[model samples]
Target: MPAGIRLFLGYAIAILVLIGLSLRFVIDQAISMPVSPLGVVVMALLAYTIFTTTLVLQRKEAARGLAIGLASLTIPGVPLAWFTFAAGPLGIVLAGLTALLAVALLRGLTGQRTREWLSEP
Candidate 1:
């Protein structure tokens, strides 16, 4: 596998871990009242991410687009990280790191090596 794919897989795994950690909050909200629509949407997106990651691992040509789409989704989070930065200096550091990671992921996914590797049989 190419470095780009490896990076994306790592990112996907990290996202899955975060989703797992947040499941308790999502479930608690649901148990106390009506299901949170945001939770539902997040779950759906998680499923899609998992599916796309699997396809990429299999080296399916279509996965290039799917993976690119997934990487693109992270772009919005860069600015959103600023909301967390309001908490403290730690938040500021975290926000900067997250923004950097998002930008790197986008570049890695769209890099020429990644495109060539994914396009191969």
Candidate 2:
């Protein structure tokens, strides 16, 4: 019911789905990857760990925690989203727009902290 729980569940569900898909494509298939299948699984697990950690942090730290969690997930994701262009227009636009939204949301969430961090003495 609460947004934080909903977000945690969303992250958990997404990670599980990613592992399932990776099992189908990476583990089951003979195709090669830039990273090993085990490596891919490990990274996904690592990311999931961060998300779960952030979920706890959110309860304690509020916007700062949510910003960190979302950043860890989406910042790297944005660049990788470009690969979607090869899949066609929908993939390109969807990824592009989602990345934009993520960036804007991150900026909105951390604007003052970011400005302060960047300020010189």
Candidate 3:
């Protein structure tokens, strides 16, 4: 597989794990209080991420754009991490690492090698 695809898959898997963890919390919150709209949105994102990851892994031509879009979506998380840095030092590290990964993913996805590799049958 192309490095770009690997990068995307790794990121997607990490997101899936995080979402799974958060879903537990969301479920607990729902049990005690009114369900938040954010929970619904997160669920939708989780489903989309899983779909995109599967297509990308299968090397579908359409998945290139889907992977790019998914990577683009993660860019906002960097600033969100930074803004929430007051919570802990981990926020700073998270923001920096997320930014680095986002940039790398964008570059790798758009690179010539990745483009050619994905274009193959």
Candidate 4:
């Protein structure tokens, strides 16, 4: 699988499982099957934003797409914040930090196909 796909799935699945564990262990509640519908939506949006920016970068709108990608990194934090309540704002901060790392990781994935993608043509 592509790194982007792998990375996305890794984060998605980890977050889901974490959601379960957080509810069970941290929040002292039973695991809800779907957890949160909004979580699914947030993941979808984050995935869309990540891949589309990559698509745009490959299509020659490199700078713009990269900026969008960087800006969008914080998207995942929203769902992480929403679903995991015990962590408070710290969870949000860490998620945003994770997202920043994800931006570079994603850039590595997207840029792997073309070193020139982020450079002036």
Q: Give, for candidate 1, the lowest lDDT window spanning 10 residues.
A: 75-84
Runs in model 3 deviating more than 4 A are 32-35, 86-92
- TM-score attained by model 4: 0.33
Write down the TM-score of every candidate.
0.84, 0.46, 0.84, 0.33
Off by over 4 Å in 1: none
Per-model C-alpha RMSD: 2.1, 7.5, 2.4, 8.9
For model 2, what is the C-alpha lDDT against the true structure? 0.55
1 against 3, candidate with superior lDDT = 3
Better of 2 and 4 by lDDT: 2
lDDT of each: 0.82, 0.55, 0.85, 0.52
**Can you list the residue pairs that collide in candidate 4?**
none
Clashing pairs in 3: none
Model 1 residue 24 lDDT score: 87
lDDT tens digits, residue span 1-121, model 3? 7788789889999889989888888888778777688788888889889998877767777788888998998799898988888588888999999899999999999988778767635
How well does model 1 score by local distance difference test? Answer: 0.82
What is the C-alpha lDDT profile of model 1 across 20-75, one tens digit per residue? 98888888888877768968887998898899998898877888888878887776
Tell me the deviation in Å of residue 121 in model 1: 7.4
The residue-level lDDT of candidate 3 at 91 comes to 89
